[model samples]
Target: MDRVDLLPPPADAVAHRADAYAAAPLLNSLLREVAERLPEPGDRPVYRLPGGRLLRVRGERRPAEPEVRTAGGWRRVNHTELVKLVAEELTRHTGLSNHDLPAEMLDSRDAVAALLAARDRATAPGDPYLRSEQCLVTGHPHHPAPKARGGGPVAAWLPYAPEAHARFPLVLLGLREDAVVEEGDTAALDALGDAPPGYRLLPAHPWQLDLVSCAAAFEDGRLIRLGTTPFDVWPTAAIRTVYAPANDLFLKFSLDVRITNDIRRLWRHDLLKLRRTDEAVASAFAASPGGAVWLSDRGYRTAGFAFEELAVLVRDGLRDHVRPGATPLLAAALVEGFEGSPLDTLEDPAAWWEAYLRAVVPPVLAAFADHGVVLEAHLQNTLVAVTDDGMPVQALFRDAEGVKLLADVPRAQGWERLVYCLVVNHLWEIAAALAERRPGFEPWPAARRELARHDLPEIRALLTSPTLPGKTNLLLRWTGADGAAARYLPLPNPLAGA
Candidate 1:
């Protein structure tokens, strides 16, 4: 690997990452729902925006090398130019100007450049699964500014970045028993390290501690440092969550950074509702027809004062849920196109896709239809385990915080969220990735069949729906809504025809 120095990356490296970072979401929003296609299609399909502005991109699934029409033919749009173009397009189309989003759009591109530079220099993890977990350079393919890392310095977040294939020891802190506030089963935290008689062991994300100011508390002896973990923990696709393979533990920490929709902190409200939501979904999977597994968020531990900042959730790891021989891979990594992704190397794409859908789809749909549990079964939260032949045999889901009970949302709203997450976000991306690699194999027919087998009324409506609810990430950010607050626009549903 060509190592980029810690100081500064070369200009070309900067441009490449920036272009990739900016082009993806801009292309995604345009191609998926916005752009008007030119009559003839070629190697590079040209799209027309409102007011007759022309846009062209390199590829379909993960669009790259964006270009726009200028007075002199087509001109390549850099990250900055693309952001301006997006802003202009959105303004013209929506009749609104979001000044903040344009800056964030630029920041996102710059963040990608930093990640790329770091990856170039750093030695990526050798383990295929870890590698897959770390591979998310594109990130939230539909979002305008997916890689924007809090608009912080490269040094601030790079060490903990999964995209950079970073693995480091957790900063172990000893919090006074009286000061530590926790609920549910957080016994797993105690096993990480020992503490004095008056203190409890609390492992923290080193990067998080740096970002949050707690020097006063540390100086006053409320919190004590007990040194870093003896061994490194592999950062999963979710940058805040790390997997300690030695202990078979998944540790999720509160990150104030805006990842996708929200500032990905383990919020108190979510924590309060966690057990209920997790239990309902877990029960559904346990009783469901398929042998799908729910990697439960057993419990959480945090400092009394720094509730969200210092919070860390303990989760069950792959050992308990995954089959003995089958290897677990992040579904997001599969869609994002990782090194060992089954989608990439599939010899029989159709059969593999069928197995994938069979393993993943039933449990998600069943959880909603039978158990009144709405799981955020997006790519990041879903894990599909493959056999020796890379055939998906089991689907394991995680993240209780994202779960919503039917009691919380009405039936229609819950169904809409389910369809969006499952069909649009998760399944659509997988099918697209599968098609991208294996050209002839169409994944939607199998997906349609999978939905057809299920007797849910929503499933029937889903089959015939002209357009699926596509989340408007760019507009969401532009309008400055809460990240989890989803706003949808209709996209031509592949399931309608296939």
Candidate 2:
């Protein structure tokens, strides 16, 4: 957990590091989603594939340096070989062959290599919050291809990548008054730049502009290209979302590229339902205990002709919602590790973790129990604000597009989604990271105490359940399932025994 100042690794070393970074999540998915665990005596635990091939890895949290048993004895597999092995095993396991996912796995590894090279040359943001937002090099630890930038050329996406510490100005555009379709409060868009008469000011992500075709609209006088914004915005872990400090605003845009499970676009259906979901979550936060806040997605603006591709959502910034004198950091980045992470220098791990639970656990549970609002309270969507002493004080949650209400879905289904996001994805990763830094620290007991205090009907079953729902991102993508439609496999529940 000690901070170190070391020179960047050489090109070959960088490639190796990238392979390790990219392989961890893919291995986690393969082990969790398909491979069956086999009893082994050595330090490395072995898994039996559907084809009866035995595989073993070096670590548990971020499994690495994979090796498979063959006629020549144990043979090491690099990221590329690992991808091939996974593909063949998945085919045997699912009775379906997928050619695209293997390519994406390779692309994800190559993207990591490019990010590592760019990060070595670029300067990280001075602000700790921005640092947390941009520090996710190994993103979505349960995903097979978290960093695949739609298999685009490195040159096309590198300049906009958050992992590269890249920041740039927004490309301003003018949607002709008659062609503009807007909902909610979008006054912030006009403040970014000015548009000529008969046009409404709209802001577009520059990378998205490259991916989407807006030339026809521009030529037909439906859309006009205004100059770029005067200020630069920093891309957050959600690559399409950017933070404008001067305006104190967060802008979520529709990018044509598929980053994780689906194409990262602001779909028309989700946008239409955004207000209801955001309002329900915002109300839930208002009624909950403690200092938890909901960073509201106020509104959106887009061209009617290209609704999904051109939509830009305006989200509440940190200034208003975050507790005063506290710096907010992305929850996922804490697990990933950053230069200014409190996990590295905390004096008391137990106290720090207790404070984290108090700040994060209550609102999420209360929202689901009392208000029937299921928030996507995963690591990426939640931010923990810490005091100067590195003690967590408050939690802020965002992304209305991911929110679901009980009216829309059955209660059991909503609870499952909440448990997956809140416990499995958010708390479990933080516990693992904290335990990795401080060996002997048991995080589950305190987590159990926190949940036991809640009076929800589901709490009893949650604490006693032998397994928790773990999303199958690998199988979901391989089978071409809709990203929003989540499928879960059972994972051993630590809370059950705590």
Candidate 3:
């Protein structure tokens, strides 16, 4: 019975994968909706994706695929364009626009022409991860030869190619921790396999030598190779490390002392910040009609420190706003304000605030209320992507470490400190920045009205609906005027049901 079950999936597992296939089209539909809603571009070239989705271009031009619509969808013109398009799309999606183009496709007109001709016959659809020949990397990852034996660690590092490549896709190459391998121990090194049809690994950079680690090896149901922990190289920092088998994520780790000074000073008082963000997102979606527009594949988290993952902005962010002469105002705003740079000083304050309120705040306030919660929607933490014409297209709320829900607290006083953070600190900062351009710009009434539109229904229904998870009390202590000794409002324990 065990062999029979192990030989093939239990049918139910296969059915679940089949469900994933069935659900993909719906995800494609959401991508289509977001594409359609993109503000019209002024002058930049817009490239169409597989499902009629579009992206606005920016910066230096790289080669792109020449595609024509077919009965099925967009088909590539030649192999060169096919490969070029995949690289460009990945570069754009990952915000790694500055990478140099691979040399194979450069300097040869005949090669380019041949590639264009071969595109359609060579590429295929349904490979969302771009597993086709179009995305093959031709070079090996840059890695140094095995370190000198003896004096350093107790063991020798060795490399072996795997029989099946994808099974060990994350084979790491690098330095070992303080402890070295023993002479008799089996050496651990990255193993490569026979090249698949169109893919190759790029070599590691010399500068990355400091970031290297020993490869971990595994076989059967247990580990055959044990590598040193990453903490060995960079110790004393509170690191937030995340791995997505597919999507690229951002990691920020600093020494514990640094985190204590940077984040904990202000936020340590708020233990429930993480819980509040999750609860607020859940409540907001619960209140929506069909449901809120959220990322099923992405969000924020904290292990020793805070971190965000699978940033949707990396793929769909600001792509449409990269037009000539148009600065991405929101990214510009954060980069400027936080970085202490300002956009051309807006001489007209009213014009700037009008744009801020209309473009930035209303949509966020509306969405927050629609979800039956409040957001720590501040300028430093919020990114607004606007069209070339200075129209706001999307607002990305970040730093879940700062999010709080109104329903999670009781009494005006309990919620006051948070409201101050949202309204006085966050919103006012943007307002003040806008005021730099337009002296008379005031957004108080407009903002209040917009927020009230969302908040009133919940305020009215509160008595009928039991109070939500009281997760904000822990977060409130941070902003209270009193020191850590301040009295904290007792909240009903949420785990009581457990």
Best by TM-score: 2
TM-score of each: 0.94, 0.98, 0.35
Model 3 ranges with Cα > 4 A deviation: 1-249, 252-255, 259-348, 363-370, 405-408, 411-414, 440-498
CA lDDT, every prediction? 0.84, 0.93, 0.30
lDDT of 1 by residue, 259-377 (tens): 76688888889887777777787788888666789998988888998998999999998887788899988888887676676765678988998999999988888888889999899
Model 2 per-residue lDDT at 463: 96
Regarding TM-score, does 1 or 2 come out ahead?
A: 2
Better of 1 and 2 by lDDT: 2
TM-score: model 2 vs. ground truth: 0.98
Which candidate number would show the highest lDDT if scored against the true structure? 2
Candidate 1 Cα misplacement greater than 4 A, ranges: 1-14
Cα lDDT for residue 266, candidate 2: 98
Per-residue lDDT of candidate 2, residues 288-383 (tens digit)? 778899999999999999999999999999998888899999999999999999999998999999999999999998998889899999999999
Task: List the candidate 2 regions with Cα displacement exceeding 4 Å.
Answer: 1-9
Give the candidates in order of TM-score, highest first. 2, 1, 3
* Candidate 3: tens digits of C-alpha lDDT, residues 89-118: 435444444222222222122222222233
lDDT of 3 at 420: 42
**C-alpha-based local distance difference test score of model 1:** 0.84
